[model samples]
Target: MEKDWPSGFPGINWLGRQEEEAVADVVRKGALFRYYGPQSPTHVDQLEEYARTFYDVDHALAVNSGTGALFTAMSALGVGPGTEVIVPALLWVATVTAVIQNNAIPVLCEVDRSFNMDPEDLEKKITPRTKLIAVVHMAGTPCDMDAIMRIANKHNIPVLEDCAQCNGGSFRKRKVGTFGKVGMYSLQINKNVTAGEGGLLVTNDEKLYTRLVAAHDLGVPWKKGLPDETGEVCFWGQGRRMGELAGAVANIQLRKLSHVIAHMKASKQRIKDMLGHMEGVSFRRLNDPDGDTGPFLILMFDKESHAGGVAQHLTNGGIDNVFHLSNYGLHIYHNIRSLVEKVPLSPAGNPWSLSQNSDSLFEYGKGTCPTSDDLFERSVIVTIPSRLTDEQELEMTQAIKNAIVANVTS
Candidate 1:
């Protein structure tokens, strides 16, 4: 470790001693699996209940990973072969994979500063095959749910809120995931609520919850040791149950989520405010539920001015910044031209809209997302969300501004 870290270096200590103690107890007793015993609350079960109460949903389901939760939710929503789900083009690979893994075609939509799916773009892409609109609350900034919901409802499509990065974010006084039929949050080590590797799915619909539970638990629809208020249990969802240690650790971290989120927001704002209004840089927009902003700060660079190359300059100067790209943007299809060619649609509609033919443009293709294509080449990620003092945030902001504005002439 460096003698001194950059103030908020360690993000959130999502796993505390309480979690270790619980896990230790479980390990000591060798109850690593669910269905360990009756009258017992395995780490996973309590975590599910905590998620329900925290998100204010009727029920919660715990799983092995965020991807797992997404897959389960997609299955529960009946999104499968020949179906389509609207997903944003500026999120983690897991978001797109969840749709494709469910055997549904992921209709990639563009994102605005909020980094959430653009409702207008989403509506433009909806079709008879569109069964669910999966909105990823990117970088903890909420999506425009009012518009998203309006379009979704009008199209008769159930919304699946992918809140993997917005662990504690909300929309209009309600949790981010609560607004949709199903919501999923990640608990990876880098997440605001780290548990090494874990995920949770929440919903107000009993039937949906039952299905997710079965999906995560390997399609075994019966409740293990938890006391079922009703004797009858469904016969579905299997192998999605979280590990005992992950569950135990999550419980410890759950109590501190609110506090941790508050600190993260304060830190996040500092980075945003510092870079906001800076020449040739754009900050993400805030439209969804305002909770603890997630762990990372997303910045868009000006592609016309060679933003990607500028970002490379910052990296060369010992300042680290990351570019955000969707799975389809990076893995499924590396270039926008190929993706559009394969999709058989106007390139104007895809998330790669910024891929203009301009010589200065970030080379994706013509008519890609004006901002995204530019940002992909020039964007910067400050730091993974970490708790820090004022001085540290100031240093980061000042450094970013200096590098981005370096030799930039009007």
Candidate 2:
């Protein structure tokens, strides 16, 4: 008789005595605020230093959220009303909203089967008014940074990478966050590294780093430059700093990230190998399989009907397999009404009229990106826990195969 699988996989836990001690230390010292540092090594400062070194970037600034990181990056890069920020058609809602938050128009570009920005389409979307190119490494898979960077370089446009879901992902052996002018990472509950709710923005350019830090910290530089008559220094900024307690937790989590990613990758690949040869089933091909963080086990079916059947079978087998599209609710760009309308509601379009390069050059509604639409319709995503024991992996793969066999007709 087969062993009964646990009710649910045990979620990843780098948090333990270390995290408890870190939080306790913060509470005891009442240094919950990042900037309340009279001590030599503050939590926030240490986190920033570690993050910068981890990604091998020159600077890293912790913020309140991933959205805050993106918005601050755009603002620092001078994205404002009437500017066009090239973004992949398929990405998290935060990616689009961050562009809008800067009062810039998001020029949604197409994505290919890789589920990343189509470099070809990205090139086509570029024009004189294009201010920046923001690329999301969707599902912990790195976008084709080589192609994207080539395209951006040809047009002399800067790039901002949305690495929220790609903490340990990479391209060509280089970490994902280092591919662009600036990169943002999320430390939310679901992310690879969690600080409850926080974000980190990293960059190699000194000037950009200074601007990003200033923008996120209410325009005040870490090292004071100038002060007004009353001895007050003023800079254009907002309160986007991460709390010291979160910072401390994040620091502990960061240390364990590599190990977490390694286990995830191993488990994901094992599952992929087990399920690859199943009839009518396909897997998302990684551009750099070695660089993948392996947080998800995504499968695709040759036909939409086949995918539907597999989804139903998985449900019947007591496994939760999500069909990326046709789900009651999705956050993809096509479903977002606010992104495809006119005036206050359609900020992207509204800015077109005011844009200096406007020839009324944007259209949004159903079928904006046919490729992205079809990509999701034929795919199923299964979440991969940070750690999966051999027995659990075997049970999971067996369940998947059982589901497919039960559903396949022919």
Candidate 3:
């Protein structure tokens, strides 16, 4: 029989009176949208300010969703039809969709044990057509940015760091998002800090910052009605601004970020100490192990079959969240139908089969990245709750140990 889990295993209360008052104040004033006019409320500005200060960047642009940030960043970087962008194969499908939305071809790259883009493969995928290299900081662990940056500089290719899953994570004392030319973070419900559904894009370039603001706000130049306006500031754009209420809540959440990260790091370290010595079970390798944000605890097995059996044992023990990612729900990368066929971006199917990508060698299928395929097949992931206690961490660690012993001992 399975051991009973802790009360907070599934989830625990995270939001409190702070978020309550923020939303209440926004609703009371009826200022539900972010705008730059003098009469506009300061909620969005405050949120952006907090992000800028936290990330230590010159600018931060808030948008409707993480995917929106990616799309807007792509647009700001001048990615359009025929542009080739290199991306990691092991990432949420939204990353690929962002490239397609910009009418660019996504050149998928292989990932190392860190579950981030392998620099060697990234370099090999680059060609004259390559315009940008988008990297995901998978599972709250930073990629080998030093190597990635060297290759990017050598090729003169810009890089966009997707910090959606790894906000506040760092490498060698440097934060994950700030390593690239542009970095994007998600404020979705499940993220480290959330505003229901919002995104933040950070960059040090002032010109790119201006373009990002216009790109997400329908190209209405800042201070359009002011006397400083020069020829009405025209630029192509897509309306994807984050709502004011999300901004308000996210601002408050930002205050709690440091405290939350501290707790998560402690909990993750406790779990690691408990389970690190287990035979035949190992955690995912990180270039900087101390930098992991502890969003999820992943275990790699000796064999794919062993991983599958352990997952089954966990599920049989009433732990339904244990996932063998090879066939896991929503995380599957193999044989994705969307990548195999042309994506529907517009009514006319403009981007996928457009003449611009006619000569591009875009390929996606089972064997696209053999390393990623092998890694996912042998991996079993258990999501670490945002709030966890020592007792709960031990229970989770023991549960995994029990499952492995019961299923993989033979």
Q: What C-alpha lDDT do the candidate models reach, one value each?
A: 0.67, 0.77, 0.80
Residues 286-380, model 3: lDDT tens digits: 87876777777788888898899888877777664678867764344554567767657777884658898877866787787888889888989
Global lDDT of model 3: 0.80
Please give, for residues 156-179, the per-residue lDDT of candidate 2 as tens digits.
Answer: 999999998888788998999898
Off by over 4 Å in 1: 1-3, 6-14, 37-39, 224-238, 274-276, 292-294, 304-306, 324-371, 407-410
Rank the candidate models, highest lDDT first. Answer: 3, 2, 1
Candidate 3: pairs in clash: none
C-alpha RMSD by candidate, in order? 7.0, 3.3, 2.7
Over 1-410, each residue of candidate 1 has an lDDT whose tens digit, in order, gives 12354433232444456777887888887888777553246777778777778888888877888988888888777876557677776767677666655545666677766666888888887876677888888766788889999998887889988887778787787778888888899887767776778888888888777667666764545555543445344444546678888888877776677877887787777677666686666765678426546576766655535455455555565654344332124422234344435342243443223232111112223335554444444555555436556776776677666667673433
TM-score of each: 0.83, 0.90, 0.93
